[model samples]
Target chain A: MAKKSFFKRITLWRYLFLTLCFIVVIGNPFTNYYWDINFIQGWFQSIGIGNLWVVSPLEGLESILTAKFFYMPSLVGMVIPVTLAFLMGRVFCSWMCPIEFLSLLTDKILGFIPKWGKDLKYRKDLVRFAKYTLWFALVAELMITMIIGYPMFVWWSPPGLVGRETMFYVFYKHITIEAVIVVVVLLMNLITRRMFCRYFCPLGALLALIGKKRQLVIEYNASKCVGCKICDKRCPMGIKPSVGESQTVYCWNCAECVDACPTSALKFVWRDRGFITLPKGTKGESAV
Target chain B: MKRERKTDRREFLKVTLGAFMGGALFSSCSLSDLKNPKTMVKSPIKTNILRPPGAVSEEHFAQKCIRCGRCGEVCPYHCIKYFDVKTGGVFSGTPYIDVMEKPCYLCMKCVYVCPTGSLVPCAKEEVRMGVAVINRQICVSWQQDKTGLMCKTCFNVCPFSGVAIKIDHDFRPYIVEEYCTGCGICAYSCIADTYPENNGKKAIVIQPIKWKKIKEIKLEDIKKS
Candidate 1:
């Protein structure tokens, strides 16, 4: 429960994760070495072993499970992020999402101006709802495509659109409709607060649902609570850990609450099982 | 708290417009390379036995490839890769077969497990997809007074077991048109040619194309061979 450095801490992890993401997005040696082989692609194509359900093809692993009923392996990318979400509740948004970092940096930059200049608006609820709606549509479209043997969602995933279109424009000087979609999505992120993640990302929601009951979660100790409400203010997702249960689906386990707690009342514990309360004679007890 | 209301309105407009744009403006630009003849290469086999046509391409391949380390997974010869999506779109989120270190041996496993038809069946037959064409002029066997040892590199690198291409007594390399599956192993493993200007590698770059039958070699042609 010892006080943690603010900008020094979060920015470190953020920068590291963003750099990896950049490498993934741009052609780096890692992807070329690990991702290109047929066996690995085949393994990924397989469903039970971890076929990303979102936008990957239904041919290899999907073919066996659904008999080619539904396929889209790009969803496999969600495995790590979704798994992290379950353990730490949307940690991907906080720790490793390139898009989230982009928006956060933009928001900070925008903060420099006063009045309307810095006070940009975000459509978290409605646009964020779009991510869920898009998820629903993706599922519905996937189901239909499975039965009909057509690729509905895969044809137009935003990730695919941006990846293909932007590269095409840059490399070949040609812009397709997919490239336009990438632009629109970026503009949306620019205006809103992580709109793609809040509304459009089905994988995020799936992980969030699982994370609500994860074994490890953030805990608020009422005994140490001064009720200063600093933790509430520090939460990026607008979650209130002080008033109620800390097991909310939006909690990303960023440890921001732990860092923000002036009295060191907040702790991230594995379940309610391990109780590592503030060290007896340290600063937290002194504050108490 | 004071800025929350206007923030909410602005948020709404942006999300609504974004979703609308994502849906309305979306198109598959990944397939642009297929349209260009310069990037297109013809396949060897006429009757493709793999995934149905219209199913395999850069865009379709991108969605289907799970970014798994598999194709790279089973390669005794590590030549495949899951391309990144953000970089130049050439191989985004798809498996790109690298023949630089070692070329493919006409093994169709890549096509078989593609989960999607990114690498189609008859990939071997689709010599247009990944065939090895030689730069004969740069080939040591074809030119230069250096020891012929460097010349047979293409013939030595060929994995079709000498059926596709052969080494002449003079150490000249000749491709057997009928036997060559166009796997590109020969071109990829060729030690004689090193040209950086043309994609920083040797070998003729083949692209996947629609399959068609290759004409039969005549007996007189065999005598010439």
Candidate 2:
């Protein structure tokens, strides 16, 4: 057995990334309050860097749907995030989302409860069905946003609410009723694992769709795999990296499965392979 | 296995159908009212509540704003505040100025940071956040005969002192509405309202101008300036 170097651990790097993201989103107000430095402004929904902009693709879509016209500035703002998704395959979910950080924390807390923690896990197939159903619900939410003539999710979006409430608390010294939605979502994590990110987040769904053919993906070398299923158990998104299912769009590129692989068989690779490509010697059929 | 697969498929269909039904029912109830231009035409103009400078019409502002809170973040004076669900409905998360609390300083950083152009970039002199109107009944300077105090707090704080607000020979202040950009500094610094007898009423207040009024005024000003 060999000791893994600290830098080799993906989990440490991910936590660091999440922490930096939290500071960027929540610390903007503190900087404004104390030093009056506003080089970077805004929350998860939209961030303005100097004169450039990076807006959430879901919000951009909603704005276009409601306004019924293509706004050039918003279109320009969408380019950065859309390009990131095209290259990284929903890295924002694992790397930058504050809600995902909270979800990971909740999972750790739930792990401490005796007996009930094990029972809370759902069957894999049931979870898959629920994810698909919620993806459809995201579509319905966009339709409602169009019908209502406003971005409906802005009211309850967990990541946006986290930033909004933090700003309110910093500026006005009192958070409003909107912070309650974030609390409710965090509480809902008790019943389901990463419930909002896995099932309900429109931004995640949008990123998933945009990054469906992402260049960065998990590659499985079948010859080296021992089939110990450690990667399966360690996957936060319930993806099977051992079976090459980590190539799916829902894979957050968090590399938990790759980190958990005991045989060092699973690895992240930059390639154009479609979803679920089995190695040449494997008897399992490859699916696109 | 075959029976389980069939049931799963049936359940999926049932859920999808239920979602569509829910969306249809919800939209049917509120779609017409939201679509009506007449309802949207009535701007969200409340006393002393001004939108940040260069804000588009209130109707379009709600639709275009993504609620990024960038405007509030870049505001130098920290005068811009967001409305939560408790404070507003469609306007929730939008940036607004409560003139009585903290007034806009006309730095115009919020306009530049707005991604969707909800707050359009404009010159400081071209701002039309609102118009300042003096309440003669409450103004100490206006009632110089009775009070004889000659308090010039508002006149002293006006950004465009000589152009927007002017004092007469008796040191009584009057608002020149044409030149007033309605940045609200005058109302924020008014001493008349701070007096215990005034019961927190502002002597000089920024009355928010609707988009229709701005369009009429700006069209002529654009021709001149």
Candidate 3:
């Protein structure tokens, strides 16, 4: 049989979406000219989708820590994405995060380079719980340091670094140390798939916490089981989605597993019941 | 019993990992920078740089601004620039207006777009950006009237003429602190600005000081011939 077209599938919409957002972010009409040289960064700063962030949750948490409730617009920014995370799972990780997109692309590109290999192989359990630990500690630090007036994690956020660098490099043709650091992190994906994201992204950790109770999620059916382990290998975060069906938040819902499932047993359950087979007619369809 | 022991070990590991990452992040950024990078050694030429109009005190502004760059987008004159990492990691993302490159035109849009109160929202008339001070020594208007070097660039461009800035009987320009909003329009529009001796500096320049520092300009401060 002919191989399935990755671009002709539902998951491709996400790649298309992130690519468009990348364009809008880089095309931000922000800065005024300095010496007729346009030094641009963060023009669509308010245009949330372009950067996939209006403001970070850490910014809101900082305001809450400082007790500036009446005027905290950052809290409002936080609410929108968290609400969306509740609606779906960690769709931010797969669909919208530029760093995630860059890392995934790096993983693909590195496949082409001869002799390039993933050097550090971590135990799966440690990687699974790593993000949660990061989220908790960053929040803990934010609460402790709020009195001193610092937005702590905003200093080296992956999303902000990607957004800011793209804008600067595309428009101003400038690259600073912060931009270089993000690129270095991107380059590390050549050594380990989604390395920075899997290990250290606090924003993803926060969203995953919010998305743990997500109503729309993947349902595993034993009736159609062949135990092929295709979906097991497909998960980007290395979560054994075939085994840990209950661990919904860790799943990016990229539908590569559903695409990879030979029996087509894996399907998205919305307002789910126990065993709703793919509605008879649409046996092999997944649209998100 | 085995399950309970495993859970305890996992909990211990999680907390240790959490504290380590947390401590590493916190100390590595601001704390470590203090000792190693010295990123926040204070911009030695701090005051001369113009901030967005209605901007709070520099110290508070630096702390308050999350540096999203919203002000730069809505700026009709597009005057705001985010200070990059070159400006110390602390000040890197804050918006600043470089007067020599692009001065604030008193659009007051930036103040409106500022998500935080880093740039306070105030009317154009109320925006005291910085005081436009004149150097009488090099001002052509201050030179010999008989030498035919008298200029009216400052007077013609003053947003609030006859009040904020005034041309005296002798044609020398004087600033009135009470009425001057420090919009920097007069300074931006100064034609008598020249190079070589002044190195292309404006004859009239806006000094980036808070309005509270202007000290009720005593009438005797200005020398009238």
Candidate 4:
């Protein structure tokens, strides 16, 4: 058999994504030279701010920390990420999330240690509730902190860990009490893959819900599935599309399922369905 | 398509009202006063090798800052903090350089790092923060030399070197008054602040005291203890 073309075998976007991950997190040492420059730092800051715009839903659920939340210098917080989530379903998590990329690398490393590695499998549906529960507790802590005049979540966030290390120790020669909390969180993460992200990231839960909306999802052609289970087996988040009518809440709209289909049957279709002409034999039974 | 338009005119008005009230309530605090303190004062000019310290009034600082943690991040020294205030209104979630633990050595990291002009840059001779008035009655060196070796802790800690503070031959430390940058290092690192609780051995309140642009204190006020 003739060798498959590289384009037909591996996704170009995945490589770009990996490249972006390396540049943002691992390549920070090089990027740190320009960390203070307006353009470079502002890019990340703007993305963070972009999520703050449609944050009304997240904010309405209030905790103390978020209650004090105000739009910063730019309105980027509320505008960009929300618009993207509405359009492409949490692409930030898949392409740009440092934590997610790190977790994947960690999972690969863990795979070398015999039986201990086998348990480190990704399951989308099983851990979908983790984000929601984490959201609830985060909001509750915000409320409690507000009444008590203390911000409890600051010491437990991933960004907080990195920040405390950079600011308190690196710059000031001071070790914050939050260092202990960061160690404990990291230890827990070592035991469970993406334990903090799956179960405790309020921001992740908010994005996941936005992705879960019916219009903004990956639709599967159940009739064309043919029980190959290739898509299910290849899914990073362990979603089983062969058994379901819809994608899981945590789906990142990565189009992996489309890539995995043996028959050229999978395609992204909008629910609006504006005059898509189908073949005659195929009655108007829309794909899931 | 028109039906999905969830927000209408009335809803827009409500949001506007909420924002206006929130902004108004927030601006009416110390932050606003710091920015536009109903008064402005002139400082005596002096030549110096180091860059002079200048700051935007507190109100202006509070309003302009977005608290994105940029200045704090960019600081080579990381001496700034975003004070989590319950009552300071606009500045409640804002950042301020704590000049006590580490004075702004006039490195200008904070001024440049501040994406917004909350911490604006200044010329060498033009910068003037509030002056430190020595409370003679409460000062250990002045009060019968109670805990004194004629302590000059504040004089030694000032980032401006001997320009902001002076120690006489008798070792009595005095605020130079004119050169005082009001960076608050003396207040923060005051050995007295670290005394009292442990049989007079503790550091107490090192508050980032809010200053008015034209505020003044008489010597009698300092002597009142």
**Candidate 1's residue-wise lDDT over B47-127, tens digit each?**
111122223543244334334333443444455433332321322334455445445665555444444334455534344
Candidate 1 vs 2: which has more DockQ: 2
Q: What is the C-alpha RMSD of each candidate to the true structure, in Å?
A: 13.3, 9.1, 10.2, 14.0
lDDT per residue as tens, model 4, B12-128: 889999889656544334332122322221111111111114555543443344444445555555455544333343234345554445555555654544433445665432345
What TM-score against the true chain A does chain A of each candidate get? 0.61, 0.86, 0.74, 0.63
Please tell me which predicted candidate would have the highest lDDT against the true structure.
2
What docking grade applies to model 1?
A: incorrect
Per-residue C-alpha lDDT of model 2 across residues B181-221, encoded as one tens digit per residue: 88999988888866788998889888766543543344354
DockQ of each: 0.10, 0.53, 0.18, 0.07
For residues A1-288, write the lDDT of model 3, one tens digit per residue: 234576756557767887776655555543233332223334222343333435555554554454343345555656676777776767877777777667666655655666543322221223234545546655665665464454545545666766666545543467657777677777656555566666666667666777777766777777886888877766667666677552456676777676677776676756333334456555434434
User: Any runs in candidate 3 off by more than 4 Å, and if so which?
Assistant: A1-8, A30-45, A48-54, A63-69, A72-74, A111-131, A140-148, A169-173, A245-248, A271-288, B1-45, B143-148, B189-195, B199-202, B210-225
TM-score: the better of candidates 1 and 3 = 3
lDDT by residue for model 2 over A66-179, one digit each (tens)? 766677888998998899898877899898999888877666666667887644442132334444755786798898787667777765778998998888888889988878
Better candidate by TM-score, 2 or 3? 2
Error of model 3, residue B77, in angstroms: 3.6
Model 4 lDDT tens row, A129-193 = 43356567556655654553323343344433443344444334555454565456555556554
Q: Which candidate is the best by TM-score?
A: 2
Cα lDDT of model 2 overall? 0.77
**In candidate 3 chain A, what residue range of length 10 has the lowest lDDT sum?**
A118-127
Give candidate 1's TM-score.
0.50
